[model samples]
Target: MPAERLDKILAHHGFGTRKDVKRLCHKGLVFLNGKIATDPAVKVDIGSDTLVIDGKKITLQHDLYIMLNKCRDVVCANRDGEHQTVFDLLDESLKHKFLGGDLHCMGRLDIDTEGLLILTTDGKLTHSLLSPKTHVPKTYGVGLRDALSEEEKLRYAETFSKGFWIDREQNEDGFNCAPAVLKWREKDGKFTLEGENPALYEAVEKNSSGKSDCLLTIFEGKFHQVKRMFAQMGNQVVYLKRVKMGELSLDPQLEPGSYRELSEAEIALLKQRQTD
Candidate 1:
């Protein structure tokens, strides 16, 4: 709620750049509480006042938190070259809701994977969740090799048993990440996948047919970690889905490629969780 220069405040609200803001002010296109304000450097309280630029009312929008049930084939980026980015799924009306900068995905999922993806305008929140120092947990559901072996499961669980740290590649800023936690679960004769010590003959037939009967996974956010882990175990990942991150889960009611704003309580809890 602190006072900020009129031009900077307008730009932050997605009006335009500083130059554009100055032009708006000088041209008498900017108004404060209904009166034309021509001074670009004039200080105004950003959190408590309404602004009008060229007759369009711009209210100070609170930090936005949105969850999108990302669908397959959509890239997890703000801009894309060959595929549709997640932002494409948002309608124009909702797109304008973003006052300034584009929304950022907290963590990424491959174009082939589908599940909960969190988007927010708050940079600090995104950094908190993705930062290795925070140790935020993420859970993924995976479809393992049809004829997965017990030995394969143990290998994934104990790959780093020797306590070695492998650094991942760096980003443009030279920030790198170390390995993350990995674990797995075998669905013992579940409804979706069946195998009750079914005769060896039955197991062989199912294996040859390329049908999986168990799920394998862990709560880790390493780059291509799930797929690579399975590959290391000599099994190819047939399907992958992120189920949870931090304290948020995909709402059962949300459909693929759709999004809704987060509730006030949800936002507060998210910040609180980070501090805790």
Candidate 2:
């Protein structure tokens, strides 16, 4: 990377304005490679040189990626007057670090929906993931108001695979969804698949009297698409939560409204899966 003015770099990192960084330099709070740096205009290599401000080292990176286990009722925006946003869950230090950069969510989840939400400062990666042509798969765990009959399950699966128009009255105005995969969950919280273990049946007999649970994987995102699909079939979606995106799954240990930086391996795998 090219060298930049010390004050410019500090301001870019949200230490403060150029004037504020100059003030900090003059006050002997800024150090460059172990020496006091009083000249704000002095150029420094951000990637190679060490910068310390007020006894704390500043580690600069080209991009930042964060994984947040979102909770219900939180909007996926940077700012909202009426409701709390996902950005509010991040630590204040991180918010200050990327103050001037283009930090945003990869995609949005409804205010009532919960689960995996990704926030990043990498605009290129964000665009690649959100592009309609990418067709990345997103998986959601859904809770229905009532259980589906065996015939209804088979019928709904086929209907979803064939794609349907969301708006029946105004076909031109409505959007058509892409083919999606729908799998019903058995009573033991396992998907009903062929050649399952006999133990699964024992558990099903022990606990099989509740609302239906299923997993839906869709390649395209539409406004309330999952809920609408269920509603069209005369069923109601009581709860919704995203569980996976591409090859990245939400960390099971992460609590609601909590977040952590993505590991280097996870970030690489996410990008790799996009191409695959």
Candidate 3:
């Protein structure tokens, strides 16, 4: 919202380098408030002033927030040597638009993980979201290698709630994980509540041969935390996909490898959650 030089703003928005924007100004291709803007050093209020280039009005936005339904096999990076990155899924125009900004993923998902990934040029928001003090909850839908027995399920839930020490390669003594929530899902996509329906439990038991599904919510992000938690319980996470972070869920309409800008309401909700 602060005033910035016209050439700097143009360069930041991917119009071109400072020299290029100055050239456009000299050519009378750049206009400010309906008048030809020949002084590249002229300062303008981005929020209130209108900028036109080549007869087209240019919207000035200093920040960008993108929600991507990330697909598996894509790394959460700008570049990867052996795999496609999440940024690679973005269109060329978007890449160019934020070229001068620090566009990056707020939080990373493993190569095998899929689902909601946020890319942003707002570094402050990213810091708030990733700060450990925020304790923002992230939910994941998990595919387990094997179904848990009723006793095993109870044990797993209780242990997770109480927190447990898990081995980490960096620390020989390992570390204690924070408490997490676990919920079991029936085969028909309904949550299986305790003593709600014996029929649903039997159905899940019969259908689950070597695989089952559950949802896990954790407040903190650690290296391979979800997979490590399952491994500590003697189970394997065969598949994992993030479904929610804070109050924002992945848009069901967005297919894998597709993305769109977050709405104003969604952006506000994330900021609210960060403070809470």
Task: Write down the worst ten-residue block by lDDT for model 2.
Answer: 203-212
Model 2 per-residue lDDT tens digits across residues 41-133: 998886799999999998866568898888888999989999999988888767754422567899999998887888988777877888888
In the range 35-122, model 1's lDDT, one tens digit per residue, is 9998999877767877888998876664668888787899988788999999899876556434434577878899988777888877
What's the distance in Å from true for residue 202, model 3? Answer: 24
What lDDT does model 2 reach? Answer: 0.79
Query: Model 2, which residues run further than 4 Å from truth?
Result: 1-5, 26-28, 38-47, 97-100, 168-172, 192-212, 273-276
TM-score of 2: 0.83
Candidate 1 has a TM-score of 0.67
Give each model's whole-structure lDDT: 0.64, 0.79, 0.81
* Residue-wise C-alpha lDDT for candidate 3, range 5-93, written one tens digit per residue: 99888897777789999899999999999999999999988779999999999887778899998888999987879999998888876
Candidate 3 — which residues are off by over 4 angstroms? 97-100, 170-173, 192-212
Q: How would the candidate models be sorted by TM-score, starting from the highest? A: 3, 2, 1
